[model samples]
Target: MVDLFGHAGPAQVLERAARSGRLPHAWMLAGPPGIGKATLGYRFGRWLLAGGAEGGLPAGSAPLHLDPGHPTFRRILAGAHADLRALRPNTGEGGVKRVIRVEDSRDAIRFLAMTPAEGGWRFVLVDGAELMRPEAANALLKTLEEPPPRAVLVLTTAAPDRLLPTIRSRVRRLDLAPLAPADLDPLLMRLLPSLSTTERATLGRIAEGSAGQAVALAEGEGLAMQALVDQVLADLAGRRHWHPVAEAVAAKRDGSGFATFMALLRGALSAAVRQAARGQGAAPWLEGRALAEWSTLWDRLGQLAAETDVLSLDRKQAVLTALLWLTPPRR
Candidate 1:
């Protein structure tokens, strides 16, 4: 299981259901990206597979705690478990696919239908459930309506609203809130011990309570991307040249760096918009701009990112278009 931190309330809720012998057959774990919804799902699976009996922690152990050395934990981690199955977007030659196909969802449903190999429980975890294609979601919805006995299906998603309404209606939804900075601190320390204090602090602020994102930012071009965003915002304020920033983002062949750039850009714009709306903390560039201008730019950036992914549009052009939003014609 992923190294889980915080989310004690959700953990206890799962434990209580197991203890009461009323554990729901279908569960929806909803939260923002990288906030440990999937981690909690995996931990719950580990608890079921390891504890064998539910309801109470052993003696003084924490809620939903299981020994890492336990055979079940090892099996699940190694993908050697017979009764445990998971579905996520499959990777293709280009990269991770954008959506989970219908066939994959069918396979998970079939796995759940089978009798537990260990004569205990069968588990299916659909990580990023919102990525399921329409056909895939419909197939899952059918099974959710009449889930198999002694089988548990867990769906974790950052965007629950993207899921089919029928599918959402069938499962017990549990929303996980973003972790606090305090909660994220220890996680960062453990996962990124090599990071300097300043680097970790920057990640914590930009990550917005996502431990996974913080770790990713620490390991990848996140800091550089962040610096670029800051430079772009400052340049916008001064009406200075932004071609260098756009060119830098466009130079990355794999598009990962560009994606990071967009995420940081969106985050920064979102903060600025909120501040502008509240009539406080508005950045100098935002002082004279109408709120709609900032909000529209933010929305346009998101649309460009999505269009680039689905339509395979030119990323360089996308970056140029986004920068043009801030470089309106001088009166």
Candidate 2:
């Protein structure tokens, strides 16, 4: 289990809810990806299943701190727990499919309908629930609408806005915020032992409070890509070479590459905005109207990113589109 950071408020809120025996059937752990939304959900499940209230805040075994030796921990970790069912994206031989299909949701429904195998609370954790297709969401909605007795369902989503309004209404929202760079430093060091101090700091900045995002960025050559973005941005006056950077980003479109690119792009614009407002940064020259252009540029980048995600727009085209817009033909 990953060490959770900077989310004690949500944990206490959940603890109170669970201890009161009034835990909601559905909880939407809404937050940006790589934050501890899913981790907190699992911890809650562990706490509940371990009969946490029976122990009452014992030092070594707080509800969130179930020792690895505990039966519940072992059961969940081994996927041998009778009452817990977690559905994540299915990566099979065909390819890595992003959407969780309806069939799996039906299986969860069936699982919920059955009596708790051990006569305790049942839990259903849907990681990245936003990945559910329409049919899958509808199927899960049916279960959500009429949940089984002694059952708790948690749907963790990076994009809760994409969830059905009805689904959102049915569940209590527990939003998780990203951790600060200082809070994330220890975890980043553990995860990337070989990373230099400078590289680690860069990852923390790019992570924007998401330990998960930091790990992904560190492993995904984010520094290299960020270097490219910085170079392109610095060349704003010259408009020198975009082909190489564009091609490089285009090549990285498959997995975390696009995300790193977007993070870098957005971070660059955000820095400019910050620099303008605060007179910070070595190049805070974008003082007034020039600084104002950052927001417009940010919006343009965001629109392109949305189109790329929703429409599956060609990666190269998306990269080129962003580049052209960033360095538009000076009118």
Candidate 3:
């Protein structure tokens, strides 16, 4: 395992599965994106291929390094390994197809029919299992109903609710929670040694327990995002017009900075909600009518986060519009 930050629960489940032969034939690893679910799945596959031995597979055995150079590793990475198969969407036109077609699931049948390359266990990993179309999911259900001997199927999903009930019922479900600050702090320090203590704390606080997100914050990306969010909030607090800020943000529609900006808005909104929960005198940065407006904006932000296509909107524009709507009219 790469020890990618967070995923303590998933790591424990895999370890327990290795110790006990009672490991389920299929596992559903569900969690938010950038949370190390795929890394854990790969680690589990490596462990199984290596016969539970540590430090890579034995010589002459199928490569289990998770490195692209290894034969089996390449197969898994390229989605072409004979014994190991990954059920995912086609990489054709239309940008990843957005859904796993029935054909993709059907491919698993061929992989399952073959014997293990190393005469041990065959592994199938479905990254984003929730993307499976109805027909594809039905095809997958057949395999799950009667799994092959010495075979393991792992499904990783950011949205489990999108999956069929039948599929969810058959597999052993592993829920992964966000990583604690203690677990994330060390990783952030290791990844960004140059970060100041204040910066690190800010990132950790905004990460909301996601190590991947924390790293983004520590790397300065998140700060830039926070600045944009702060600008909008500050303008609203001053009773200033928001069109200029909104237009400025909308201009960078597809930039990476926009994504970070969205993350910052989410983090700030979360902080505001926590402050509101604590009642007055919670956050030193908030006071007077600013606190009242922030509390109201918190509810609106929560609703916006739940929107189906929130990600598709211009990052700055979306957040700015929300701020503008929440801002009090100038006298």
Best by TM-score: 1
- In model 1, residue pairs whose N, Cα or C atoms come closer than 3 Å (at least 3 residues apart or on different chains), thus clashing, are 19-55
Please give, for residues 1-331, the per-residue lDDT of candidate 3 as tens digits. 2555656556666766755777788999987765667777886776566556333444432222244355655445565655666666665456746887778788886687578877878888899888888898999888899988888899999899999999999999998876677776787788778887777777777777766677756564676566667776665564355655555545553455555655577667667757677774354335434656776766676666445135575555565667656556555
Candidate 2 displacement at residue 172 in angstroms: 0.9
lDDT of 3 at 267: 68
Candidate 3 segments exceeding 4 Å error = 53-82, 91-93, 186-201, 211-221, 231-236, 240-248, 253-263, 278-281, 284-321, 328-331
Candidates ranked, most accurate by lDDT first: 1, 2, 3
Q: Tell me the tens digit of each residue's lDDT in model 1 across 76-134.
A: 98989998898888764378567888999999999999999988889899999999988
Task: For candidate 1, give the lDDT of residue 148.
Answer: 88
- Pitting candidate 2 against candidate 3, the one with the higher lDDT is 2
Identify the superior model by lDDT, candidate 1 or candidate 2: 1
lDDT of 2 by residue, 1-331 (tens): 4456668788888887876767788899988888788888888888778877455434443336666778888888888999999998776337866778789999988988888887778888999998888888998788888888888899999999999999999999998888777667877788789988998888887667787877777678888888887777776544456667767777854745766787688887887687657856635324323666778878879888877878888876777778776663445
Better of 2 and 3 by TM-score: 2
- How does each model score on lDDT? 0.84, 0.78, 0.69
Q: Between prediction 1 and prediction 3, which has the larger TM-score?
A: 1
* Steric clash pairs (candidate 2): 179-209
Q: Best lDDT goes to which candidate?
A: 1
Task: Give all candidate RMSDs, comma-separated.
Answer: 3.5, 4.0, 5.7
